[model samples]
Target: MTLPRIAIDAMGGDEGVRTIVAGVALARRRHEGLRFILFGDEAQIQDALGHHPNLSRAAEIVHTDRVVAATDKPSQAIRQSRGSSMGLAIQAVKNGDAMAAVSAGNTGALMAMAKLALRTLPGIDRPALAAFLPTLGDNDVVMLDLGANTECDARNLVQFAIMGAAYARVVLDLETPRVRLLNIGTEELKGTDEIRDAAAFLRTASGLPLRFDGFIEGDRIGSGDADVIVSEGFAGNIALKTAEGTARFVTDVLRRAFTSSLRSKAGFLLSKPALHLLKVHLDPNNHNGAVFLGLNGMVVKSHGGADEKGIANAVHVAARLVEADLAARIAGDMARVGPILSEEMIAK
Candidate 1:
């Protein structure tokens, strides 16, 4: 199968060119016909490519020493994006130079640049940041608006639901993804007016390729009860951080307990296999890519501190989304429900 080339911000990650190059090389080894356009310092990228002959043969370099600093705000970053690796990588997507773009850079800056360059799909008011979260169910759950818009109206939440469900369908390979709104309670009447109104809209809207399971409390986020969980950015961001923190806390506690004494050490040795599986499930690297949904083009964000394995996962994510034609899928879904959204907006 012929895959679309991916544009990467080689100088974006915390580890800079070396880690990004190594990760791209790893992804190339794992997936055949994966081409890359590395945006960074030409000499540095060339030096890194020397170590990976396979990648060297399949990759091209677009030199640029300019970078978006971690500390740079979105406002400032947008002004200087044209010459930065992060900006150019996203630009490649808008310019049709690449099918998708991947960056391990400033989240705010990346979002700003991508929005400015790619714009949102016709029916979407704004793009939401969506990512896969490990779940106890057979498939990972998709959550969105992790930090894109702090406050959202009922219309925004409804759009997020559609976008999130479309993403879940592509990534999880489900025909009808079950979706829920993040709320304080699962009761019929709960959350703010926006949540209730959004639920009402989903309940009445027809022909959507999703199953609306109503409001899902924060505590049940990982219960796998729903395939897609939609929320405003403020709450969504807090929920994401809390889940990550809780995972780390659990791992730390287990490590301490396992080394407390000889008895515990013996128990740990006996449970090594189970523990290994648990570790793999909890590792952030396994779920590293956060995609910007509702955008006219595809752009994925890799955690700044992600290692080669994590970065590779991000690249693979971009590849899968491109292969699935995520943008078109979303556009189609939005078009299907455009009339419903318009009526809802008019009613408000």
Candidate 2:
């Protein structure tokens, strides 16, 4: 079988083609059979490739003069960006030229371009952004709707659950991932109607390849309360951002405390290896890809400011999803829950 190639938007990130090309080199080293289709300015890409001899052979560049701006709104981006690097990269996935597409551009813009070009899956109403979150357990937790679909209905929530669970199966290597809804309380009657309704649907729904472990409050997210936590984009984005901020805050505090005195500095040197491990476990660069799930083709959104390691991690994620055939898994899961969704709609 032929190995899948990943299409990259080389002009999409904060640092431009330099960082992206370096990441391409890193990904090439990690995955020997990987190939890349990069979209950006031919001159700039050529210049950037000079430093990475191996990547130049594995990558094929498609040049476009225009680049999507980070400040561009989703509507404006879609309207004006057909020939832009980001749009062309996503179109590659839509056209079957690439197995998956990766970009570090504007979140709304990438989602818009992907949806406009590739559309949603059979039973999925909308695509949700999903990412891995470091947890107290050995395996990382998967969370969804990080910044897509600010408002979602019960059906959307259920669909997110299905997609998140399928994602967890591949990313976390689980036989049956424990799925949970992010809610105010764990009580049966707590949370909004949609939350309650989604919970009820999962409880009675059969044939899906996940274990619905009821509602989980925000406090338990870092503790690995569930393998997959599903939420609407509004709340999910807030949770994601808050957790990021708290992680930074703790790191900053630790840095300051360890440097405040000579004794503390000596202690820090003594614990350098353990602290390095802690940093690796908490680093966002190690988990830099946010997948736009429910699309017909795979679309991964990398952090705009991500460095080479982060971008390489994002590429790894896209490659893994392609290998796992995420869309097929979603379809299989969706088919099982069809009757439950229809019955609930009829009851409503």
Candidate 3:
């Protein structure tokens, strides 16, 4: 199958042109059909392209020395976006120059530009930052609203559930993903008014392609009980950071325990293979894409510190979503239950 072209913000990440070029080169090697349009400094992009003849042939560069700084606020960056690599790349999506855009730049800036350029899909109040989280189940869980909007009402939470479930179906290949709201407790009376209202709305809705599994506590996030977890930006961001911190803590503790004594060192050697597997599973690079769902066009956010492997994974995610027509899937699901959701929200 022919894949859609992706526009790359070549000067956005920590290593800028070098990292983006190297990652695109690696991705093209694995998927020869992948195409890219690079936006950055002409000389630097050309210099990096010299190392990968295949990518040089597949990519087209649009030179611009301008870049969005790591410290630039979203509001400030959006005004200067016309000349920056991040801005131009997102514009390519809006202009149909590329089907999707990818960047490892300032997360706030990228989100701001994409939302402004691409706008939100019909029935979507705001876009949510969604990503896959490693779980103990057969597949990873999809979590949403990770720092996009600090505060959200019942309507936003319900919309997040619809968008998150659509994302899970495309990425995880689940037909009817089980979804739950992140809350203080699992009981019916657990969370705040917004959470309960959203849950109540979802339960009464008849036509969405998701299974409403009620509330899921923060501790149960990694248990794989729900395919999609929804929360307001404030709580979602905290839950995401806590999970990441816990992963690092476990790995650090294991490392220290394995080196405490000669006997422990020997034990570590005996369990080398198992430990290696665990390390790979916990590596953030292996799961590097965070998508801005509810957008009219596709935009993927790669980790700013990601290496070639991480960048490649992010590109792969963009490709998968484009191939699955995620926007249309989301729109269709919303249409199916739009009336029911509106009526329920009004009744409350």
Candidate 4:
């Protein structure tokens, strides 16, 4: 089988081309048949690749000097970044030259460029940012609309559930992902009208692979009550940030406690092996990629400050999405969903 090419915006990350090139090399080890189309400054990219000759066998560079700044607003990036490396990489997906595009660029800028260049898929009004978060359960939970759209209506929430489930199928390898609406309470008559409406649709909607498990409260999110958590961006963003902050806080407190005294130091040595396992599970590098779902083409966003390992994980995510045919799965399910539910929503 032939390898699919991935387009990468090599200039956008905080660490620059060296990290991007090295990341690709690392990803190559995981995915044997993957190829690359790298976009960035020619001289700098070449310099970065010099340290990783193994990358050259599967990579090709498309040099462009117009780099999108981390500070650029989405509007500004859409207008001025059309000729930049980020723009070219996105364009590669639009032109079908690459299976997907991966970037560690400005989140706002990448979203703007991707939306403008690739547009949303059919039956999708807005593209959502979806990622898998490590959960207490045996599997990760899929959450969506993370900082993508600040507010979404009933239809939008329902759409998010569908797309989020599609994502879980790929990333989590779930045969049938359970979908839940984020609510203040799990009771039948709680939360906003939008949440209720989405729940109603999911419960009644037919011909889709959705496993509607009713409403799940915020507290239950980490408990793995649902495989896919659907919320508008405002709440989703807050949940994501809060989880991250809490994780860091616990880590800091643990470090301070472990070194507080000689007794604690001895205990720390005894617990070092278990702590190492915990640390590996908590590291963001293991889950570095967040996908933009419902886009016309595939795009994976890496954390801006991600190192080579993180970038490689992000690249691998793009490759996996391509292999799973994420876009086609979403598009197919969407076709079944629209006709079944749109009329009911219109009647309401």
Candidate 5:
């Protein structure tokens, strides 16, 4: 079996080297043929792996002297920190040293470095962050532009829809996945003129092989209204964070309710297993990463606060996407979209 090599930014996230090293170990144990190139300070990584005999032999490390801080501006970080761990990790993917790159560092910096190093596909203008949201129903939904591009035009939204639909088809194995634009309401005139115009474009677009499901409101996200939801980065980020906050609030309320009294505690004991299962299912950590779609290679962004388990899950997600041949599929799908606007049209 050919093992997939993933480059992990070992110096990223709050847990730093420990979380990344542990995640690599977990990924290797879970997937037989998954290999990793851990990028960071060589001494720290070696020290972290020193106690883990099982993981010491299975992974390789690339040493870097600098690290990109979460607070650094994306453009400046990429420019000034050329030899930083994050930059080096992305470079590994560009050099074909790895199949995918995973990082829990500053998202903007990662995007900038990735775009600078790997570049986008032929027809893609900007890469969007695509994430999976588990719905109440059977099928999951893919939301895009989750804070990658704060302001997007009508054409950008349409492109996001196309890229998201392609992701659903290839990564989620959904044939003819339903695509919907995230809007304020389901009514035709609910959102801005941009959304209205984008809707028109999607309706007439012939090349994208997807089931365009019109508009989907923010409230309907968890209701399973569509298989893929498209939105600008600002709105998408708000929607995602809103959902996460609500989930946390509900869990906390439930915990307090269950511990109120002896009888309640007894009831909680009986319900502990089910609650644990639910928590695992709904925990953001289990689904804490987003893939920067439309790029030449796979790049997954882990939450900066992610722990060992969360980091492991992000790696798992990246490995699964690589195994599914997501990048090639996206390239093929974009190819099928035919000739986009020429440089002149774009300049206009």
Candidate 6:
């Protein structure tokens, strides 16, 4: 088996070079064939990796003098920080020097950099971010457009559904993943005019192999009614944050209840395993990264505050995506779906 070469932005995130270097070392241990190209100032990366003997021989560093600040605007960063670590890392993937790129920088900056470098697929209008959510059911659910493009048209939603379905099939190993358009209500007449029109397009569309389950209510996201959920970036981002907040609130409440009294503390000891399981299921760190779908190459966006373990998981996700040939599978699925709207329109 050929080893997957991953380009990582070592200057990204709050923890800076230290956590990024630690994450790379961790991932390298778990995945023997994984080769990494760390993009950042050579001195900083060397300083961080000096403590880890294993990483010295396992990874290579690609030096970049510039760095994109978290506060920098996406467009501005892409333009001004052309030589930044994040930008150069993405460029490596675009130039075929690396199979995938992982970054823990500003979400907008990462998205803009990737768009400018890798570009979207042949028929994709705009690429979107796809994040995994743990459902109440046995299988995990995929939610998309996680603040990639704030606005989307009916055709864009349809494209998201198709791309999302293909992603679930390849990544989640679902044969006939059920896809649903995220909406306030399940009724066809509900939501904006664009959504109604998009729903109609999906209904009459042909050759999209997966099961289209129509509109899904926001409340049913954790209910596991569908394997894949599609929505515009603005709405998807709100939904993802809301779920995270709810999970945190629930955990806090449980913690308070478990420590209120001596008896409660004793009971909590007995329930520690169950609580650990719940925390694992709801923790954002466990699902810290989102994939930039519809791009020609695999790009993963890690949380800006990601720690060593979180960054490691993001790299793991990127490695799996490359191994699974996710981008090629998505392109094949789009080709099979054909063009619902004008080919020229989407290409533009």
Best by lDDT: 1
lDDT of each: 0.92, 0.91, 0.90, 0.89, 0.86, 0.88
Question: Ten consecutive residues with minimal summed lDDT in candidate 5?
Answer: 338-347
TM-scores of the models, in the order given: 0.97, 0.97, 0.97, 0.97, 0.95, 0.95
Q: Candidate 3 lDDT, tens digit per residue, 261-292?
A: 99999999999999999889988989888999
| Candidate 4 RMSD to the real structure | 1.3
lDDT (Cα, tens digit) per residue for candidate 4, span 1-348: 667899999998898789988998899888878899999998988898888878888889998989999999999998987989999999999999999999999998899889988988887889999888888998889988889899899999988998998888777888789999888988988998888888888888777677999988778888978899999999998998788778778989999999999999999999999999888777777878899999989999998888999999999999999888899989987887877667877877
**Which pairs of residues have clashing backbones in candidate 4?**
none
Ten-residue stretch with the least lDDT total in model 6: 339-348
Name every residue pair that clashes in candidate 5.
Answer: none
Candidate that beats the other on TM-score, 2 or 5, i.e. the better one: 2
Residues 93-155, model 2: lDDT tens digits = 988889999999999999999998999988888999999998898778999999889999999
Model 6 earns a TM-score of: 0.95
Q: What is the lDDT of residue 297 in candidate 5?
A: 93
The runs of at least 3 residues in candidate 2 whose Cα sits more than 4 Å from the true structure, single-residue gaps closed, are none
Model 5 RMSD in Å is 2.2
- lDDT of candidate 6 over 1-348, digit per residue (tens): 646699999999999899999987887787777789999999999999898889777789989889999899988897799999999999999999899999998889999889888888888889999988999887889999899989999888888988998889988899989989999999888999878877887786666767888999889998888999999999999999999998899899989998999999999999999999998888787887799999999999999888888898898889888889999999988877756445533453
Candidate 1 off by > 4 Å: 1-3
lDDT of 4 at 336: 79
Off by over 4 Å in 6: 340-348
Q: Over the full model, what C-alpha lDDT does candidate 4 score relative to the true structure?
A: 0.89
- Residue 106 of model 4, lDDT score: 93
Residue 246 displacement in candidate 2 (angstroms): 0.5
Question: Against the true structure, candidate 2 has what lDDT?
Answer: 0.91
